[model samples]
Target: MRAADEQDYLDFATARVGALYRSASLLTTGDPHLAEDLVQETLGRMYVHWRHVSVADNPAAYAHTVLVRVFLSHRRRRSSAEQPTGALPEGVATEEDATLRLTLLDALARLGPRDRAVLVLRYWEDRSVEETARALRSSAGAVRTQSSRALGRLRSILGDSLPDLTRS
Candidate 1:
């Protein structure tokens, strides 16, 4: 890419970083540092593949797809154990809802990669089942089925703590 092209990409990446990192953090279970790494890798890969991606399409979505795949594939080659975002700073204490969040995370981590990916794409990214199916190389029926099962599993794991319709 030319110098002007690099500068334009840099501007675009800067503008999208916060949103991308937030998505990454959610996917990474609030691990800011790994989310930062994921964001950086996604940006670098996007920069490399910019020529193939049409300017007419949504670059952010394209980059996000790449980020999610990279994270999933990276996790697949490793163990199921998840690391934290390192110890909190001096004044930071544990979250009041830590147990609940951990329960949810553990449940999510138990899902197969595609299953977990679908939940993130559906609930976290708010993608339609069709969009998620396309992204995950599956049929819409599969996305729907998997998402339903995943939600059932999470609800089972969280039980009463999951939430109540009666609660505000």
Candidate 2:
């Protein structure tokens, strides 16, 4: 274990798993198993590229990118399976804060992958519009348009139940 061979990779994983799972949970609402799978896949990709990433940078952000790519590619390869209520774990199983969390997750799932990524990075990851644009490799103008349109779509999906998104 030389200094350059920094096992800080391991340190980062252990410290960040909770947040990563939370993000994955948001990304894959009804499927805890698939959420774990996506997080694992993202971790693996991150491990392979860890040399280029740094202790100072947000590894979670990089992992978010991997999750978005994996999620989008998975959708392209196979139609999303529809599991009935009986098949999915009860939303009641989620701890306190389930309501808004689940609502946001539903809104996120409704968005197209890139738009979803923008919102997730912007809100969950606490990135600025400029940082988000850089992360998504998009121009600031396009990012604003996409994020605005995405929230608008969420407003439509949730209507009176979620009018607050519309106010933005």
lDDT of each structure? 0.76, 0.70
Candidate 1 local lDDT, 1-168, one digit each (tens): 988788888888989898888777667765667778889998988888776663748887777788888888777766856665443222244574565566666666566666777888898788988988887778999999999998888778767776455876
Which predicted model would earn the best TM-score? Answer: 1
Global CA lDDT of candidate 1, please? Answer: 0.76
Model 2, 41-134: lDDT tens per residue?
8778777778776553766677776776776566567665533222343446545356665666676666776777777778777888998787
Clashes of each: 0, 0
Q: Which stretches of candidate 1 lie over 4 Å from their true place?
A: 79-103, 163-166
TM-score of each: 0.79, 0.73
Task: Give me the runs in candidate 2 sitting further than 4 Å from their true place.
Answer: 1-6, 79-99, 162-168
Best by lDDT: 1
